[model samples]
Target: MTEANSTPSVSLKLLVLVAILVVFAVVIVLLIFFLCLRGSRSWKRRKLAVKHSSGSIPLVSKEIMVVKTSDLTPATTSEIGDVEGDPKKEADVKVDIGAVTAGKSEVSGGGAHRSEVSVEDPNIGWGRWYSMSEVELATRGFAEGNVIGEGGYGVVYRGILQDGSVVAVKNLLNNKGQAEKEFKVEVEAIGKVRHKNLVRLVGYCAEGARRMLVYEYVDNGNLEQWLHGDVGPVSPLTWDIRMRIATGTAKGLAYLHEGLEPKVVHRDIKSSNILLDKNWNAKVSDFGLAKLLGSEKTHVTTRVMGTFGYVAPEYASSGMLNERSDVYSFGVLLMEIITGRSPIDYSRPPGEMNLVDWFKAMVASRRSEELVDPLIEIPPSPRSLKRVLLICLRCIDLDVVKRPKMGQIVHMLETDDFPFRSELRTVREKDPVSSHADVSIKVPYPPPKHAETVEKSRWR
Candidate 1:
């Protein structure tokens, strides 16, 4: 009887243990279900926040927003005007800064947004975007007669907008390597910056494989045509006009070098890249080849790409580019302007084939007057001419360190007083073995005694 009672007790203990385990499992399942439900609710709330924060403007993906396409449609303009007039419409259109800021912070890991959308300006809505059909209609289907200019990059056509506004449209060549990057660079470089000297980017069109840039129409032709075209010799540029062009070009370059936040180096500073307005004001154009320099970085290393005649020697050889390289090219341009000669001409005598070399030889021999263009009827003041020549020599110094900065060049050009003294020193060419090779020279410039006086007097 006692054995039977002990067996019942063991069975009772086993039953109680099983019941406790079942209750624990049910509790765990309920807890898991509650957690999942909470997570779902939180996700829905965040989704609603994003939805409510974005107004009429579609929430473009990060990639599209970064590109900043300046395409203004007729409908978009009308919508913008309506928003401006109606307070409620304006409020609806306005972005919820708090939500956007929070979302961006989460998406970017608390880092700044790389592709932040700029607040739309009421005066100028976002840039106008043109459809491919509209561009074709404006350019007459890219007809041959409509083409105004052509370069390695692509062809430029004169287009008339519906409002009778004239624009120059650049159609980038489809097959060229890095054409898209070049397009983006041009748009980014010139889109934000506005100056009388820099070319204005009105709008752009990127439809399918077609990439085009629209710019304000400059009435007068380029400096290259005026300086070297068939009409150059017959109707020579006057002394005053030449000076004005030089001064204006210098100011533009100085602005590019110093005025912008991150300075820009115009890799190709040649006569062909400089355009003239109706008033004959020089405006720098063709920023497709421009390079940006950060505040800390002094130079960039890349494959040298520029016109052969206008490229700086150091840059052409080693592919090291900086503002000084641009200065060297500008020196060559100044030489061309003075001599009315091409940078390189096969027709010229072998000794004078290269304008820079010939100019150097003349300056080394103290016969710079002979280098002046014969087409110039009324010669510039002798002192002024000599000063300009010296400035050019300093700009093209063999040692890059010796080259004057663009700002200094501008001051030297504008002031009557000479601020620096030039000393010419001859050095052998890179090839020490070749006696027949032309010897490279260095022109060092030391500040003159009267530099301070000139600066003070100009200010006074």
Candidate 2:
């Protein structure tokens, strides 16, 4: 009786152990099922949220905001030494897309078009989304004749909207992955950026795999055409006009660098990117590769991307980028403006192949006047030309830390006083009789004392 009872007890224990194991397994399976269901619901909710946010402008992400420097009521001078230069202390420029005409005359506030939207509107945000069909109709079925410009991003076509307004539509390349990325980047960078000098983004189209961006139509061609096109032996851009273009370009860049809260770094700052309207006002265009930088971050380690010959050495080598990189490119652009030469020309003799090297050589040899574009109708005065050249050199300094902020650049460009005016005065104090003897000391624009002697001795 005892043996039989013990065997039964052992069997019962085994059975209990099996039952416990089975129960644990079932519990695990149910838990997994519950987790999967919760995850699925979360994913669906996210998708729906994106869909709902599509038609209307979505709130700006933390990484980027549609905030301008003027909105913050910045101090007169940046704590980091970036100076804001406005001769009249005018209010921020406001642009109206609806009233924009391709070749309109300047309105009251120096803008080509009148502004309908107030800068203070909180509702103001990125542009609207257009159906693919609407874009197709606007471009007239993407006719070859409608193509106004072509770039690495895609082809730019001139489209006439139903409202009788003209627009430049960029049909992004069909590389599915890259096209989408660029579309998002451009929309974020350009949308809601309100500056007279910036090409305003009218709208965009993202249907299926296709991507398109519409910009305000600029009637006059880009700065590249004015500088290098087949205009004739004598270019129509007078010294005053060139200065105006330069100053405007500087102001636009200053706005981007210092005027915005999280500043915009225009990775590319070449002549081709500077668009001009009928009034010859310089509007900085092409933000396809632009990057936004918050005040907290000193730099971003990004894949080096920009036009060759304009890339800053520090950025190109290490892929570390900041506002200084834009300054470097702007310096190269200034060289192009002053010399009327491409940044890199393979056809030229080896010594002159690179514009930067050639320019440095010219400056070192005191042949600055020789490097001027012969086409310029009226030559800039010795002092004025020298000031611009010095600024350019300062911008391109290999020691990136030494480059001036864009606002400082604007102030230097617009101010008639030479940067080294004190040094010249000191020399004059030491040698009172020969104060004007040094031809290099004179500033630009209005000729200095002993102008005839300086003109005959140095400028010629």
Candidate 3:
């Protein structure tokens, strides 16, 4: 009986030792897990601090963020590389596109869901990435029937989205060396600007050697087509419609020149780049050649890229571009609108081939009436028309400093009391071939009762 009791005691001691070992093992595992958890928390805190550091990144809306290629999934990275060419090069290209700060809330089944869409980089705002398949489907596989326009930049197609929204898709050519750079420049330039008179960039698709830009579709065609298209002589654009186009276009340029933090100079401001909406509201388009002027800088020196006849003399000669350069182009457009003639017409007589030269000759000879378009059914008030002509002359002046600012031009167009009227009249009278002996030309129309109304109705 004593031996049996001793055996039970030994067995109890063994059981106690085994239980102790198991407890020790469990404690070690818990300690390791806790240490790992603490390390992970510290790492995450460091990352957050870096991301939120001041001045390192520009502040974007909470919902929108810049995306970096390195942060993208492997599949996305490969796709982007294919569309944009060298992935490293594309990443190096800095585009400051805007992103939405908040995502749309959706209800699925019986639950409310909020989806988080984020970009990889936070310095530049977000640019929506469109898959190739989506683009193709929207464009009907880029069918020939969908083609709207084509030029050196690329072919533009009318695309209908799944949401039934219409968009203009520009498929850039692949072989041009500057295509990628132009794409980035256009995306960044138009992305930052929001104006009723400026075309809006909807999204972009870059997939393996294919680069396409999506833009909000304007119902009516571009100004070039209306002005010079094969449409017969009985064009629908009346004088009032033409004036509206000019004023709207001027407002757009003014905004680009003065409204933004850094002024944008649209290097190409020809009729071809001005698109019209259903209401004949004009919006500036194709910012591929646009240049931004910083607050401290007056001009940027770059290679001149614009149409032959519409290019500013100063810009074309010296390769120096500024707001004044665009003013010159607008002056040409103004002349085109008044006379219903292209800036250059090879079919015209040699002396009249260039519209600017013809205009100067006509103005010098006091035959300004000859410049009016015969197609105009209801001409503007004589005084108003004279003011517009004088403004155009001032804008296209040989001396860049003499050109009026876009804002000033807008004011002059709305009001008959142009600040430079006396100076322009004096210059006209001093011409050796002046037709009239008297220098006094009275203002035909009385000034508007409410001068401020001009500003409010037109510019504001």
C-alpha root-mean-square deviation, each candidate? 16.7, 17.5, 14.4
The superposed Cα distance between candidate 3 and the true structure at residue 457, in angstroms, equals 38
The candidate with the higher lDDT, 1 or 3, is 3
lDDT of 1: 0.66
| Model 2: per-residue Cα lDDT over 60-162, one tens digit each | 2211112222232111100111111225331111211211111222235622221111122233356655544456678987899999898777899999877
Q: By lDDT, is 1 or 2 better?
A: 2
Model 1 CA lDDT for position 176: 45
Task: Residues 325-351, candidate 1: write the lDDT tens digits.
Answer: 889889999998888898878899987
Question: Where does candidate 1 stray beyond 4 Å?
Answer: 1-126, 420-460
Candidate 1 structure, TM-score to reference: 0.67
Q: Which ten residues in a row have the lowest lDDT in candidate 2?
A: 73-82
TM-score of 2: 0.67
Query: What does candidate 3's lDDT look like per residue over 334-452, in tens digits?
Result: 99988889987999998788787788677766677778887677777766677777777778877788788999888878775655546646755675433221222222211112211
Pairs that clash in candidate 1 = 70-128, 71-128, 71-129, 72-128, 72-129
